[model samples]
Target: MGIHQMQSDLRAFARERDWEQFHSVKNLVMALSGEAGELSALLQWVEPGQIGAWIARPANREAASDEIADVLAYLLQVADGLDIDLEEAFTAKLAKNAAKYPVEKSRGVSTKYTELG
Candidate 1:
């Protein structure tokens, strides 16, 4: 499904459980960070190539997926609470990044934007 549809479904699920009362933007943001940390923990000490294999394992994959879902759920909840359109925000951020990392300066490089030009 599309992102908007996924967001709508998540919002409905939260409302069904009366979770909106505890899903303030601040709380959601903190929860999102915690979930991301869990996802990161799975990659700890894993080589880049091995990461794919680890994530491919059923149990590992499920854990990673759940962590990612948690992050997305909280992010969507925060966006909903703040009335922010994720698609619009993403597009705007992409535009900003494109300007900050023009291909001529950033191509084949992984340096920060400040180091580019």
Candidate 2:
């Protein structure tokens, strides 16, 4: 489903459980961070070369997916709380990033855009 629909459904779900009070932007952001950390913890000790292989396992992949969903859920709540349009924000940010990191100077480089000039 689309972001709006998902946000609506999430709001409904939380409303049914009276969880809205707990979903203030600050709380949702903190929860998002926790969920992201959970996902990171799964790969924290894995060697970079083995990272892909480790996540390829069914159990690990499932766990990671769940953590990702948790992150998204909280993120959506945070956005909804702030009345932000995620898609628009993402498009604007991507456009700004592309301008900052144009291909000529950024190609084959990992340097920050500030340092690319």
What C-alpha lDDT, on a 0 to 100 scale, does residue 39 get in candidate 2? 87
Q: Model 1 over residues 35-80: C-alpha lDDT tens digits?
A: 8898888778889989878878899989888888888878877787
Q: Evaluate model 2: give its TM-score.
A: 0.96
Candidate 2 error regions (>4 Å): none
Q: Give a tens-digit lDDT track for model 2, residues 9-82.
A: 99999999999888888989999999999989988899999978998899999998999999998999899999
What lDDT would candidate 2 get against the real structure? Answer: 0.93
Error of 1 at 42 (Å): 1.4
Q: Which residue pairs does candidate 2 place in steric collision? A: none
TM-score of every candidate: 0.90, 0.96
Candidate 2, position 88, lDDT: 99
lDDT of 1 at 99: 96
Model 2, backbone clash pairs (residues 3+ apart or across chains), number: 0
User: What C-alpha lDDT do the candidate models reach, one value each?
Assistant: 0.87, 0.93
